[model samples]
Target: MSQTSNSSSRLSALLLAAMACAVSPAVVSAQSADSATAPGLPATPTPNATINLIRLMVERGLLPAADAAKLVEQAETEATQARAAITAAAQPAPVAPPPLEPDTVRVTYIPANVKRQMIEEIRSDVMAEAVAENWAAPRTFPEWVAKYKFFGDVRFRYEGDFYPDGGVPGGTIDFNRINTAAPVDYFSSTSTAQPPSYNADQTRERFRFRARLGSEIDLADNFTSGLRIATGESSSPVSQNQSFGASGGNFSKYALWLDRVFLKYEIQPKAGSSFSAIIGRTENPFFATSMIWSNDLGFDGLVLQGKRKVGENLTPFFTLGALPVFNTSLNFGTDSTASSGGGKAYASQDKWLYAAQTGVIWNINNDLTLKAAIALYEFQNVEGEVSAPIDATTLNTTSGFIGSTDSSRPGFAQKGNTYIALRELTNSTLPGAGNFQYFGLATPFRELAATARLDYNHFEPFQVSLIGEVVTNLAFNSGDIASNGPTQLPGPRNNNSFSGDYEGGNVGWNVNLQVGAVALQKAWDWTAGLGYRYVESDAVVDGFADSDFGGGGTNLQGYTVSGNLALSQNVWMGVRWMSANSIAGDTFKADVLQIDLNAKF
Candidate 1:
């Protein structure tokens, strides 16, 4: 056994010597290549050299294949230790004064192999410490995923409404009455005639919540795509709040709707100047107050915007866009056996909105700035035309009046537009069919608006601003609206005119003053503002106006006060109150209050 052991030891020594000769030149070549490639990169072991050493060992019977692998691993480890030691020693050591005696000399020495072993020991200790501390390599993400960004906000609110005892009044119930004539009562019982009365005094309160999630993806260069999903009823284009008990019955999940999906590309002609074009269902592109368009309204179309810096403080911008409001196709041609044979058939023309705005921003020194803009919004095919009814089947059976059987209209009833039915004297051939009603729009809308804002920023951590806006409908004409309906009233056995008291008004305006932090930041940051507004029924499309004013849109005059306080960097509390009354045709009044807790991430 002793003789065998000695022989094995000799064989191991021979294997080590052979491996050294085979690996030395390859290691030097690797070092040379590494030096040429980059700084601080260690030389890599040559697999061919190591394999040759291992083959020689196995062929000569110096070691088994497995043992040869172990031997090669051990040699590589030693070489790594040697390299590390040499690299460390190459660093310049701290300078020390010469020995006090001029003839005296100092010397320190460390054996090359011993120094290399010490380095290996130190490296082993460092690796063990790292493992004990759970150190790990950083995680890696794919290139596309790295380009994505996410954002969202959550809001919880308490809303209140107050209505006076007088209730809403002034709208005429008699379809055949003109503006100059006395109006009929709308709330009277069928058997008894009573004066028109307002709704009784009432107060309502509810809790509501809104949430939105959005993501932006960097497609390439200056192009980006964005998507946002929000919680709300699909029917409302201006609100995302989900009121408690909105489901009508037991607890139900809130509805999720796509709020924005758009693509944007930015062009830079020079420093500090840019132009962008956006398309799809996107955020509002025009700079205007809620008097003309609600802040939450999204435009489904395309927008072009440009900004140019003139000198150092004067910058001008402009925006242009076109949006499709409604689309429909109908078959209104005559057919004898058709469902509406000689009856009214519904048809609608496509509606579109085109808008253009230009504005300038001026910086007057460091503490003050002024901004102003003018815009024009025009609508095409918004007016409707009613076909003459050939028989009684075309008339509204419930009211014995002409009404639209077509589902498509420029706007919904909840939007506060007055819908009139055009009719002509026609006798019913059928026994029970009443006189035909042909419902259509009696008014057309076109608006020109101007707005101005002044900002003073002298107060640190606080901001002060004043804003004003005015809008007028160029297409409004009382005579035209009054003349659109039937010229003569149908016989109710009494005298009545076909035109109700709908005299179109053309002006709307709002003014506001605000003092607060521009945005909520850390805890205790706050803001407050007050404003007054008067919106004529015809100045703007009530359907797209601010819904919170006058319980939901146009022909409203009011005052609003709002305040907000931040709870944290990304959370805030807000309160708002609005008291409003109708501008015309109605004596409606309302008070709205909202308390909100909001958070963003």
Candidate 2:
């Protein structure tokens, strides 16, 4: 209908133009006058262009105004029909196309430099945030939520011991050994000049305190670094203040030492395994609570540990690594001159100690587990200075004849005239006192250890556990011997007074009881246990005369009673008492009490 209207309008415009030109002035007037009588057609023409045709006709005396209007309307109607037909013919044909929606497009790219700049900006923003909060970057945080964390342990202690004296009474003077070939003033002490007696006045009062501070940083998803400052024999160089001398003086010196500083790599296992790699100083993986014969103590090495599940109930573990052993020295004199024998006067041997080990762990059941391990440790060789004989009648004054021994060689004989031999001694023919001497090698001394541990736990109302442990020195088993030098018995062994071999085995055992949730469960969760240890060592001292020196054995047996009380999940306290018996018939005892608190942020 709309199309028809548009067509009709066009036709009317054409017709109007044509008619205005075609009609004469007189004819238009006559036609308009006859319109009323002959309505179908205009009767005459008139010059009506100046006005609308109807009005012009009326004024020209052609017809009445009303009849002229009617004729004009009829002409307009016919013209409308004609225009409709012509317009319809002139319209363009519509074209068909597949249906679709127009799509809008956008493009974007980030150049390398711009991307880097944006990253730097983000980092700066993050750094600012960290500083405002007194926090660290993501790499420094121990956990996802913590950018950085501070952790430390402080142990305040009041300790006491039975033997207030500096050392166990009646114990043999073994300082004849010195790590250095020459004397070191820094390592020597006054104790070596004169042998101290077991006088009550020399005993010491015991008091002690220890602390540790540490932090961890996460460098990446699998990498982390941790450092700790600790005070204690196990962690640091500070010896515990077990007692005070009778003179009312501290017997042990306290100092700070770095316990641990290392980077750890945690490898995410594929499905059911665990792996860890550590670089720098770390603890040796061994079963014995005490590192009786392993060199994996302190810094300077790398370690690898891995755990894999072989079966449903069996998980095997292994550790491999090398560590450097630090030698300890004691001085006997206040002067630069090294002492012939006794405590206090030597320096640690300058050499690198090497070690390596591998081990496996198996779970027999929920209540039983077992571990087997083997290790190789290399210790630096220790050499001592030799002294000449003092006189023939007074015995060797320089050798400080603490005991006496006999040798086949004339020089091995004592200088004393008619000297009475109090004790019989066993002498080894092996050279260098069977010290496994490899003097030519850059690093000569080493000791290997093999250990096995079996543990059992019974879960009833209370948790009860039993652990049995054993260790053996592989160096002894090898039967390697240094050259048995000149049989000079009365004099120091081959210019080395401290020549000797370390041979021994250790056994340790422990029984643990975890107090069940009994009447005290509401207030205290506790565990009480007892542990026992035994060490047997055979020490051989060569070059002493039968009248002055001898080699003997030392055995130590000790027991520890410990109790643990958990005030709460985050708070706990522990107490322990340890007592030991030396082969020399000396008894020593120590007691420790500790309190600890832990919290989560």
Most TM-score-accurate candidate = 1
Superposed model 1: Cα runs more than 4 Å off? 1-140, 169-201, 329-348, 394-408, 413-416, 422-425, 428-431, 435-441, 487-503
Q: How far does residue 63 in candidate 1 sit from its true spot (Å)?
A: 70
lDDT of 2 by residue, 1-601 (tens): 4554665456446546655565567666665554445443344554333225554445445445565566576556655675787788799888895665568444479999999999999999998988777577444633554643567755455444344334444333222222112211111121134322222223333455556677787787798888876654433121321222322345656545677788889885765578998888654444443424222234466777787777776666666665543333343232322223444343433434455666677778876676766665554442221222212222212233221111111111111111111112123232222111111111122344556655555654455555444443333221222232222222111111123432222222233333343222423777776767554321111111111001111234556676766565545566766554442223322222333332211
CA-lDDT, candidates in order: 0.68, 0.42
lDDT of 1 at 67: 56
What is the Cα-based TM-score of model 1? 0.68
The segments of candidate 2 whose C-alpha lies over 4 angstroms from its true place after superposition are 1-149, 164-170, 174-193, 196-204, 232-255, 291-299, 326-354, 376-462, 477-523, 538-554, 584-601
Task: Give all TM-scores, in the order shown.
Answer: 0.68, 0.49
Q: In candidate 1, how many Å is residue 515 off?
A: 0.5
Question: Judged by lDDT, which candidate is best?
Answer: 1
The worst-scoring run of ten residues by lDDT in candidate 2 lies at 543-552
For candidate 1, lDDT tens digit of each residue in 145-215? 77899999999999988876555433422222221122222211221453333332568888999999999
Clash count for each candidate, listed in order shown: 6, 48
Relative to the true structure, candidate 2 has a C-alpha RMSD (angstroms) of 17.1
